[model samples]
Target: MELYKWSAQATGLGCYAYFCWCCFLGSLAEDINESKTSCCCISNILAVYRMKVRATLKIRGDSFSDACVVCWCPFCAGLQMRNELRNRGLA
Candidate 1:
């Protein structure tokens, strides 16, 4: 009778250990899935932000070039020169 009781207790302990291991594995899988999802979200957001910054920089560069062209033109250069002279009280 004592031997049977010992065997039953050992079986119960084995089942409990297996159950705990399965729970730990399940939790680990969930954590990995969450990490992957978070990484994807962050990457997508960065991609969008990068595209917007590129577009804004392109527009700003184009505007600056246009202004430079206007300022360097003979017709517009005189106006700018006069404005500079006036600011220096030389006009």
Candidate 2:
């Protein structure tokens, strides 16, 4: 994942997420749910969505592992998703 490769859009998203992570989560969740990208703000649903993201990105992990990552550090996960999507021209 291009974690350090922040475009203007990603930079803005990172800033927003850094300050209002909950709100950012909600926004990202909506994007994930409504757009071709997928996920949700709720922890349970988000965990499931994280699995989908893993599949979409071809990342290696199980449901429990993805859940743990999302639970512990959703912002990082979101940022990674954003970068991946942008990289694939899917965002």
Candidate 3:
């Protein structure tokens, strides 16, 4: 995958993101029996963040699709976003 090829070029952003995801998952496991809304809280936040990143980067995409992509594979989404920012000399 492109991610693997670009692993050597990856910035600290990806590692930070993966750490956050791991922490979120750990907390979620502890609250596995909690409400659905609680479980979705982090996903929703990340989705909104993704939308903002897309908008700020002037990337052409719909918010809903961005949310879907973030929710589906946040690790990849974060990596792509970081790469975009780096490419633009903003990261």
Candidate 4:
């Protein structure tokens, strides 16, 4: 009877250890997912900011603006240029 009791206790401890390991792994996965999500959010924000800054510079005839002109989506940039021109009384 004593032997049986010891075997049962050992089995229970093994199961407990397994459960703890699984929980730890699950938490690690969540942390990785959160990090990836935050990175994507930051990348999107930077892209939008770059677009706005490019538009502003293009409208102002800044030399650095000539590096790349995304003519495919010209409306935003053109509007920016027009607005700047109007603001400067050059329109």
| Candidate number of the best lDDT | 2
Candidate 3 ranges with C-alpha deviation above 4 Å: 1-41
Each candidate's number of clashing pairs is 0, 0, 0, 0
Residue 75 deviation, candidate 2, in Å? 1.7
In model 2, residue pairs whose N, Cα or C atoms come closer than 3 Å (at least 3 residues apart or on different chains), thus clashing, are none
- Model 4 backbone overlap count: 0
Ranking by TM-score: 2, 3, 4, 1
Better of 3 and 4 by TM-score: 3
Candidate 1 positional error at 32, Å: 75
Tens digits of lDDT, candidate 3, 35-62: 3344356667556655766665556778
The predicted structure with the larger lDDT, 1 or 3, is 3
Tens-place lDDT digits, model 4, residues 17-89: 3455334223322422323233233324323433443353342333234223323332233333333333444
**Candidate 4, run of 10 with poorest lDDT:** 1-10
The candidate with the higher lDDT, 1 or 4, is 4
Question: What are the lDDT figures for the candidates, one per model?
Answer: 0.30, 0.62, 0.55, 0.32
Off by over 4 Å in 4: 1-64
lDDT of 3: 0.55
